[model samples]
Target: MVRVTSMAMASLLSHITSLSLPLKPHLFLFSHSPKPTRTLSFSTPAISQNPDRNVPSSFNEDIGPYLSCSMPHNNRRLKVAVLLSGGVDSSVALRLLHAAGHSCTAFYLKIWFQEGFENFWSECPWEEDLNYAKAVCNQVDVPLEVVHLTDEYWENVVSYIIEQYRCGRTPNPDILCNTRIKFGVFIDAISSMEFDFVASGHYAKVVHPSGDQIHKDSALELSQDTVKDQTYFLSHLSQDQLKRLIFPLGCLSKDKVRKLAMEFDLPNKERKDSQGICFLGKIRFSDFIGRHIGEKEGVILEAETGDFLGKHRGFWFYTIGQRQGLRLPGGPWYVVEKDVKNNVVFVSRNYFSVDKRRRLFHVASLKWLQGLPPNQMSQLQCKVRHGPGFCNCTIIIEHGEDGNEDVAVVHLSEDDQGLAAGQFVAFYQGRTCLGSGVILESWDDQGFSVCAKALENARMEDKSLLGKPVKIKVKPETVATESCQLDGMVLSNQRPCKLST
Candidate 1:
């Protein structure tokens, strides 16, 4: 084994940090790795090819007229606290707010990380973030505030994220950071700071209140930057958080924001956008996870026959639909199910087969943005992850005592591959994002979970259990199809609430 020093580690991190577009899309929403100067994160798409065109940065073509639908777009300069990640997006937001004559203060939130996991999960560069943040603040003559939320972040987001993964789920830390940290702890921190509203470079728009409804009740409109629109991450933000917050670069694209940073002569204009977990810096998912969960040896069995196909680093190291790192023989395989307690990974070559692909699943802890959306089952578009384009889905929810739908069963029009537990599902009607929920389980039953768990008693050292007879259980049949109401209803029901183009 080679000995690694902090100097060696720093150099490795610097090299790895420059690698943009991490393998994990959900965590790298804001890839703000530290550079010579600080950079702000707007969760923008890859830099556009053409940087010259200052595209119309509005919900629609007419921004002024659009805001006029509810409230005025312009108002007197107000003291705003901007969440600056020391990147181009947030930096530009800060400059714009400062230029517009709003009293601005840049805040950099710090989160928890493994003490010495350099090769995989990176250490948070709070010091460098602060330095570049200061550079921009000094240039604009604005004050910078760095709130160390390591304890709270670990307590609320980090622990929950790790726990979810350990329990065989792929949790999205970005969503949690928005709900529990950025909009949660940070919002409460500034409650007495006398700041009018907290702003960030997130590519999301806050639709001003409708009618006499002033601040807190305003709706969240999808940003004009559709490709980079982070309404998915911001979907869990409460109405009160929306009221006290502002997204400065809501209408601008990533490339356009970069251009503005250049035009403004911002100090950290060249700083690469951070490809990281909210504030946790860009890290290798497996390495970061293993640091907390530790690695355990497990068997990778064939999904259909329960044959001992191969071995995995750990069940926690793999996820549903993952094709890489199997290190097995012959051909590629996909993880179908994870037996967390038994430490077994179920894989199959037939990823698109009848027994594998799924179109429907159950989700617990359902939350509806703007109150409960249509109690009746309605057909709407939903995205499984942070990417453009959506699949048609019929929403099935069961209401709780408070008249809130605590449990939801999403019925997809077609089977989708790569569905993993613990991922966030966002509901959308065209450009307007409705809300999101956590995927509890899929309706899959191919002896994937049960067969894998019974391996020890079956004596699998010689791999005899590979072809053992196992009965497959289907979700609808096991959970009662009558309750899901999948029998007698039409799914072509579209909501009349189509958003403006």
Candidate 2:
């Protein structure tokens, strides 16, 4: 609905035109949207309220000293390419890099989106964002490059998003997209551009020990910004990837980044942080998903009796633990289960009622981000979603349906209601992110995925698609009548025919 004028769009285009090697236009199918310049209000938290003050920001902190102590001394400038999204965190990173005299180049990535979807997903325009990044680069005197990843984004990122939702998993496209695109595609681009390293404004850190033996092959060390830290999402990145990565904003808390952005006079000093899909702007999850996937209205049910309660807008619109928007007439109710096949969402009068205890869900497609062997993963702590505190649960890794390996179920020693199918179940050891895997299924069954207490302290395996196919039997007579090969596998009484040789 919101449109940017041609003049404004052209102004943003000038930077693109200025590149020595012209960018391929198809890479950027993104159109500009209209947004207002914001007057920001920054409220400093009370000293007691700041749980992340321990995170180091300056060159004097523990992280800085650790890095300084580790590597061979070099006076040469660190050539770092930052994935600038034109936000406060990134702006601060640029300022920090520039101040440190690092040979910093800002690469502004442009991924295409549906026209009106921008307003629905985010408030800022992609063109305006690119322009802000250019302005900062021009002011900071660092070269900025713009790369449009439209097609690759759709194929790699968007396609995965649709598939994840279709299969009933709440996939974190940002993390996957970051792993595959920003670090994957964008990093490859920088290799051609001759940059020494890549950086971003992500609120997570990577560190190495102080010694001659560079921990280039070592795991990424967790930063102190646990509240603002994004290490969980970055868990999928490998040691090889971390070898050339930098996080200038990782050491700083969100507040310090804002303060530094203000002190640096960066244009996006007060820009609000993006909340939803990586590039897609402020659109609601269900609405944005609706643009790509069909929104089929489903039945709402009572958790105990399975009685029809009411109709739901769409199952895609809700997650497992959601409680606020059920619109029920009875006393307050919570969604206890979703029957994606029956098109139903089940609710309960009391969320923690004793009856809710009997039913449990199963998890599948569990991946270890670090690709840790099955042994180390069994010992780590797991977080089912972003905001919830880490739960002390045992990890179970086993082969599952169709030759795919998955996480069967995370048995919470204590029952926590509102478990959803498509969310992440990240594993951690203390502050270090061991790795994370997509939650496949969850529920209590005999021999549920939990490792035995003696084996609970074991590690995780890194094999992909570990489940065997479910074999079904088709009517034997039909196969013979149809002249189909009788040797094919049968699952749930449905035999898949193999064509006769």
lDDT of 1: 0.61
List lDDT for all candidates, in order.
Answer: 0.61, 0.53
Deviation (Å) of 209 in candidate 2: 5.9
lDDT of 2 at 150: 67
TM-score of each: 0.74, 0.69
Q: Quick one: best TM-score, which candidate?
A: 1
Q: Can you write out model 2's per-residue Cα lDDT over 1-501, one digit (the tens) per residue?
A: 223222312233221110111021111111122223311111111112223322134334233432342222455677777788877777677767666667776777777554455344346477677777766776656656666666557756677667656655456666667766788655654454456678788776666433476643445545545556677677766666777777776556677777766766677877887665665554555666787787776656555554445667777666554565777664455555555654556565555444445233455434444455446544555555443255655655565568434444455544555455555556667666666555444455521122232121111131112133222223233211111110110101111122111
Write down the TM-score for model 2: 0.69
Give lDDT tens digits, candidate 1, residues 325-361. Answer: 7765554456677777677787765665555446777
